[model samples]
Target: MVASIKSAGKLSESSIRSQDDLEKVVEQEQPKKKWRWRVDTSDAPKEIFNRTLYLSILVFGVLGSARGYDEGNISGTLAQVSFKKTFGLSDPHKSKDEVANLKSNIAAMVQLGSIGGSLLAMYTVDRLGRIRALQQVCIIWIIAAIIQITSKNVGQLYAGRLIEGFAIGQTTTIGPLYTAEVAPPQIRGMCGCIFAGAVYFGIMMGYFANYGTALHMLNTSQVQWIAPTSIKIVLAGLIFIGSFLLCVESPRWLVKVGKVELAAQNLSKIRHLPPDHPYIVGEVADINELIAIEQEAISGSGVFDKIREILTVKSVRYRFFAVATMSQLLGQWSGANAVTIYSPELMGFAGYKGVERLKMTAVLGVVKFISAYASAFFIIDFLGRRKALYTGITLQMISILFFAIFVTVVPNATEDVPLPLTASEDRAAKAALASLYLSGVGWTMGFNSIQYLLGSEIFPLRIRSFAQSAIMVLHFANQYGNSKALPKMLLSMHKFGAFYFFVGIMAISLFWAWFFVPEVAGRSLESMEDIFSLPWYMIGRKGAELCPDHSEVSKIHVNSSGHGNAYDGKLDYDEKTSVHHDEGNSLMVKDSNEKDLEKEVKK
Candidate 1:
């Protein structure tokens, strides 16, 4: 199969000009007695998995670790009496209002930086290239880390947090995007999971460092602030440098931007594929198909025209909506940032004070990271995207319900508001905090990792980065909303009110997933042409026969002639056939040219 695909390389000049004509002629022949699926790296040498793919995926994980360090370390560092004093947050017990306002400002402001970074990422990701984008974000993280380390007051800390947020947004957006484009399709989901797991690892590390740093403060004065956590700044800076030197560029991006030779070169370097390796050939073919699609779209010019082009593609438009909404909503619903940035105090409200609450936060981060790993390994193959998310979202909604029940109904049942500190009451407070941690566990496993992975997968190359960035920005916006709103809502309307709101949102999102989001498990980007043809009703409900059988191929060509020379196995504007397919059967295949033309116009 690989040999046949390789032999069918490079359309000739005459053949190229009359692709439509050639397709028509090719269609008349009863399809050969062969499978109709495209080739991915499934049968490539085990060496394909040797060092390069694993190392690259792992390096992507390191990116997550660096991110995790920053995410986790802040909570611990913020707990130190001296560290809080440096930011004028000392005596938080007496100045709770002032400290709370400042903390809120920090949380809200980081998202503002994320807004800028997210917008920048959308514009520069494709322009600067994925590796370069990641490198730049790394630089930002290092700078922000340094700024944070030297901060003198709440204002400087705010600046540093915002800067860090920007870097985080870009890293989150590009890291997974790069992983998806570069990793072997067989392990793509796993690679994505590695990145997510790395993040959790970082979060756990941050918590560990923070706990160690504040644990009895036994270190010398010069190293007091420089104990376990002081190394975090160095670790972050090192990750930035390492990724810049080590991470490979996405060959697909290189191909899309007309750097075919460079794309081929990068593909070889990253895969460690010898010249003429089957993987390289399959990759090149895949690249060529995407390039052709983009070229067709590029016939339009001018910035506005290009922007108009993006808005026109049905896939792009829908992806943009779904990704953006998911980015925002998932972060919020997962209750991660809310818990990480504010829950220390919230837990304090329930009486788990000092390093205890901080440790719990770290535990939650670990749960998130580990679960992401689980999702990465099993999501693509064992459970399709829909089932994983269905399970995940359902779990999160249930957890949030129980949490709200604890907050509103259970607390009332105890009749324990303002209760005296009996051992029984202390036990109850501890139980409540434990429940919140459990809620964090459920939300992180499903919503956090799946949303990032799915958002990156759903769009085509022509505008994937742009679409992803927009979605990520919206994710930050959602995070910001949750962070800001939850605290205020908790004060104003009580905890259950906030949880109930998330419950409603997650319920709607679950419905959206059941009905709208398609399952892309175990399928390559090219295979997505099948997904394009699927009706909304069939999405996530059943799998489509993406690769036609030899018999179906014969039928396709037999009924396909003179139906407009455009059908290259993609759907088109002719809605009568594509939209109204019979039940238990998928939508019709379409012409490559017509689909590209239509996608370009739609964008």
Candidate 2:
């Protein structure tokens, strides 16, 4: 749209040109928009990130997928190589206890490393920028890969797994945070799931890589070990280089570290703001406001006082508890990781032998990848976070229950269960495999993806890193519990009983999530402070709303029927006037300080 120029009767052509030039100059100094827009501070959705932000998030997601691939690939592909032989478990006739112990140790080692990495992440993620720390972890992953590839003993190999697991822990925490922080509100939910989806994709890649390698007999040769695992190494190297070169470091992190100028510059670049764009101005203002809050929170405080402040903040406390507890519960009870880390062994127990087990794992990986992609696109938005989680968890619980019942009833009735060579075959073994595949699909849709997304959402800016790290630790603890005990439990109680244990845990998780887990689907990450201050019921209810038109202040009415009504409005807080009028001329309050009192009334 062109600005209309009005010429008075005495206007000169030179003056008109001069006026036009001044208008151009003013326009250049402002953010160009198709139309004038105003964002209401109270309910505005987060500013949509620009091309740079999307690129950075995508890069991080790719690296995250690679990291996830490394975590699960070793489980399914170990059967083909001297991984068993190299680990001194070549004979199937070995004592069951010995084999169980060794596998447990390998699985347990990853959890151990995760524990360490998580603990370290809690402290360092804030100090080091998210991109910088992830870059450093890429180096750590490479070293771990080198150790695993060069190992002569099981101990060395396990050590490598531990180190890699540690790296993954850091990756898990930072990758989601990076994506969440960078994403535009329109796509933030999808962006948050990108890592989980990527991981599933990576799992598929790892499975295919291993399956093909096994078919080609690559891992049998020393040179092939380097090639197969080298895929990750090359990916890791690319991630490190890409992060430093192409990735945009978080503007939030820059602001936190007192780099205001750098933060503003980065924000402008990430938001595609012209030098004097309005978005740049708004971002700078937001940054300053946050910094001011941070200063006020920590001012004149010692270390203990600072800690007290964080703990005392309702937002921080609720998020920390919600994320940590949910992670631990889901991690232990979901049974997806259990199936992933021990799929080969579980398939063996179900009577699959030789390469068939590995192929089945590849199939499982494919199902997981496909389902995760579907969920990434559809579930988080259409179903809302809480409902999607509820549905997914319920389905997962049913799948596990079916598995348990089948093992207890059907498998016991037949002396030999007929196995199908193809997915089309209607054999009992194929049916069981199908059940396992469905179990993975349920998990990808619900627990695994939801946990990461929820963990990122619950925390506010001040303790986002700390809260996520705490949850990660709890998550691994649950993983560790399963790795250390599930095998032994299966040995003593049978496969049916082992699955029953997970079912029981899943039932509890479902209940906890239903009752306690707050919905955070469309809420801006910054609005977490507002969410936490609400009652539990309201928190999840609002979380279910679509976008909430956050670009303006929302005036909400307390309904007599208990379902509230909301509209866009300005909350006028005039200290001089005894009464404050909402945008609709509604008497929002009779006193300016009544706004503070109204919070208590709402509670």
Candidate 3:
């Protein structure tokens, strides 16, 4: 293109020569090697991160406290003696195994509903906008909470849990994603960790709420269950009101939809800078530049066209599967829900029951919340996400195995009779309890938050909502399977045997993480597309290579749908632009993903 420039003699020959010289200067200044671009916001002047950003992420994180409350409250409710009598859950006519089955369904039904919620989020988050999707889910949560409070029978309770679980699934999918997209790259992990901390806080709230209900309404028929169920409604109400007033739409989403000017305005608001500020300009350029590359990947094609490519392309499928599905599997298969959901039953294996069991369960929630809090604040970004997760998984495996052995070898007499445990048995039970607490702590430190964090990080802008929804679908499905199967697994195969199953799964997960969990920490969200577009083998080693800088990036055109199917080698800067140039068949870039593949195949 430079060689082809024609002059109309408006300027002197000296001016024309200077133009060519400027291009040469840029070439001479270019770097010799390319690697991941790191954004270090920690060192940025204090003003770079403002109160508004913190407020936004904190409000979003508060949504997690609602989730934690719901999850932990149930463990306490299940241990309530009157609550069981109220439901006939432990009737003498029902066999011990039948009761276990009923309990499993009650625990697992919410996960079934969550599966549907996750699928709905995939479409709603993309089509309706993130804030609107969250608003709708909060309403659903409130209605579900009402049902649980007024539930007349076990069926109604089941229905309530299922519907509420659906809402939980969507919140888990969208909340972290919204926070991740809105925050600057330097503080992105810290913001996301807040959501994880909130969930643990919710867990703590739920535990106390349930304990308080059981304490005050010791003899009340409906208040025992009704009071604890009502806590979710309060949390949901706050979310509903805040989702609109407090939250802003994702700036990246605005750019994807062609509202570039508005995206800049919103970005300015997020950064506490004017639209023309250098930092704001740099971020908008990054988003637009990434959109440009992603557009080339599916250029001139309909939405379904790219979907087909994502499905049929072997490398794309593997990459997508590793993130959206396999990462979820690794977390769920660790037997976390099994150990957590039925804490009372787990303690029965250690001869702790009644108030003692509930206390132990609450203690576990406190442990998990504390560990998650510390890890989210001080550990995740410091250790780096991948290292923290892998190390934590190893700890969880060891702790859970010790828990299993403690139960199997030093059997709890509570398994045979409801009698209070002997002194020696109580000591052993407490030791086993400590091991289980360590397991929760380990899981909380790593896999607990990383699934949400990694899901937010892995996908590019165009398909992120879709990819994360897919990840959450797999997430809910695993939760459902574990919740449903855990009680039966404990009853039939024995409780310790279930731990062995998780131990094997964790062992396998270590291998999976080593091969597929690439190091993406400190990288900008815009650069994620480069990583996901890589061929299969290069993943988990070097991540997506950095593209050209802003000035060069602006030269690449964004197709109508933000994805392009053609590459003319113009963006390479090394190539001389030509209108009629041919690469072998001149059919290059005809395929959807052929844009990124050009460099690979040419090699």
Model 3 gets an lDDT of 0.70
Residue pairs in clash, model 2:
40-551, 40-552, 43-550, 44-550, 44-551, 45-550
When sorted by TM-score, best at the front, the candidate numbers are 3, 2, 1
lDDT of each: 0.61, 0.66, 0.70
> Could you tell me how far off, in angstroms, the CA of residue 4 lies in candidate 2 after the best superposition?
23
Q: After superposition, how far is residue 17 of candidate 2 from its true place, in Å?
A: 41
TM-scores for candidates 1 onward, in order: 0.77, 0.78, 0.81
Residues 528-584 of candidate 3 have per-residue lDDT tens digits of 655656766667655533332223212222222222333332122211232222121
At residue 456, give the lDDT of candidate 2. 75
Candidate 2 per-residue C-alpha lDDT over 51-154 given as tens digits, one digit per residue, 9 for 90 to 100: 67777887888766755677456775456565676776666778878888877887678778888888788766787888878888898888888898888888
Q: Show where candidate 1 strays beyond 4 Å.
A: 1-44, 90-98, 218-229, 301-306, 349-351, 409-434, 540-603
Better of 2 and 3 by lDDT: 3
Best by lDDT: 3
- Model 1, residue 513: distance off in Å is 1.6
Q: Where is model 3 more than 4 Å wrong at Cα?
A: 1-42, 299-307, 413-425, 533-535, 544-603
Backbone clashes for every candidate come to 18, 6, 10
